[model samples]
Target: MKDLSYACSKFPAVSDPTADEVRRLRAEEKLSVRQIRARTGLGRNRVHELLRGVPPPEWTRRPNAKDGLRAEAVELRGQGCSVNDIAQRLGVANSTAYQWIRHLPLDADEETAARRRAHSKVMTDARWAAHRAARDEAQAATHRAAAGVVGALTERDLLLLGAAIYWCEGSKSKPWRRQDHVQFVNSDARLLGLFLRFLETCGVDRNMPTYRMSIHESADVAAAEQWWVHTLQLPATRFQRPTLKRHRPTIRYNTQEEYHGCLVIDVPRSRELYWRIEGLVAGLGAAIT
Candidate 1:
């Protein structure tokens, strides 16, 4: 109080050179907070306080692929575009697009008449139905035309075709051991029925063969047996107890309602019939050659 100038000279004032250095790097060097921290060893909060009111450089903003999308969403929201429209246009999920533009109010147009909104199931089906119908009709026409080409079969034709079918599908006697019985196993009901017709043509009794069903343990054996009986027009007594194949849960199988398993046709005392099938197969090979 006695002498202000004299007191000031006795004690020199101090300046924050650290703060000046931080500002210099931030403004002139255009270094990010991380870069400044690396260069100056200043704490993050301190550096941030020093950088207050100073906009960060573009590179320091951590721009990414979504930044453009966010900016576009904001613009769309300002224009009163629905979140649904924004999502479809931006190729983003509805929830994501909502997060981007939730602050904006939806317009009254969303409450318009239902006829114009094509969100209904009927409207969706209408668009593609005609095309599907036309394709189905064309396919059915081809099937009908092809079916007409195979008119009727004579007894000789049945004998040849059935013999070839038996050679391909029916079990044969191996050279290592002697098996003289006729055994045919097949899953297709049509093929088995055709084979039955072939047996009738050969003068073997229609009821001579023993039938058994091979099915998965997981399937309804009784239902399957009933299905076969109904399909073949054979008595339930004709079918032996089904041979249940072990079920492997890890592997997917045809276990649906329509999955009736293979039928085994075992004709006992058919050594003569087995030899006849071998001869027919030999004849086919020779005819083809």
Candidate 2:
């Protein structure tokens, strides 16, 4: 490279007060470039170019905001501090902290521990994945085991089960009303089918039971009526006018596409059958005890 002194001397120096005066004000007087220009009556560019070769005063070397932090990060890293530890203590971005000390060598033990920790994390993640797969397999196996325990239900089993179910869900005789009508209302298709089988077993005419659907006004009434008719295998004439319930402020979760609404099975003039079901429930309760 050309000598800086020789190259600097080539540029024409300002006159009147001269380049030495600008350098003197900048160094000894500790004045800024603008202050030097104002004090010496020289243009900003003239003063700046004149002082270009001159060594700046201590005040001119403005300390970077991160200078102290960078030094601390380097020192701390040499003393076994990790990047995260240095960043937090020095209040610098983790990436900036890493850049300050990444070239430094760590102690042998610290380097070994860092490698082991990284390996441990990978091992832990693999073990957790395996555990999750095993848990899913176990849950599926449990469901299959439980399903196998409950085999097909016999006719007698269904009769007892239906009677118990009807006792829980169907309308019963109350002291105030004295009504013993065989009115079974349910939303479950399986329960309704079993109840239909129960009615058949009792020698009741399937056509005699008048069907009605109780549903929200917002629901597809015609679709629900058709679904129930198809599901129950009943004649359209046997079905009565459906009862539409007014919409509440909060609707039910059953308002989805699969919701066909509750079916009401009313067997007219079945006071005797109602009494027999009540007796059957009573006998079942006594047997269980």
Best prediction by TM-score: 1
- Provide the lowest-lDDT 10-residue window in model 2: 11-20
Candidate 2 residues 15-54, lDDT tens each? 6458778888877888888788888898988887999987
lDDT of 1 by residue, 1-289 (tens): 4769976888888878998898888889999999999999989999999888887877677668798998999898877677888999999999999998887665546554243454555777898799989999999999999999988978887788889889889887888988877888999999988888888788776578889999898889898988988898776777788899997767665878989999998887899988887888898899999
RMSD of each: 14.8, 22.0
The whole-model lDDT of each prediction reads 0.85, 0.87
Error of 1 at 33 (Å): 38
The candidate 1 region of ten consecutive residues with least summed lDDT is 112-121
The list of candidate 1 runs beyond 4 A from truth reads: 1-131, 251-253
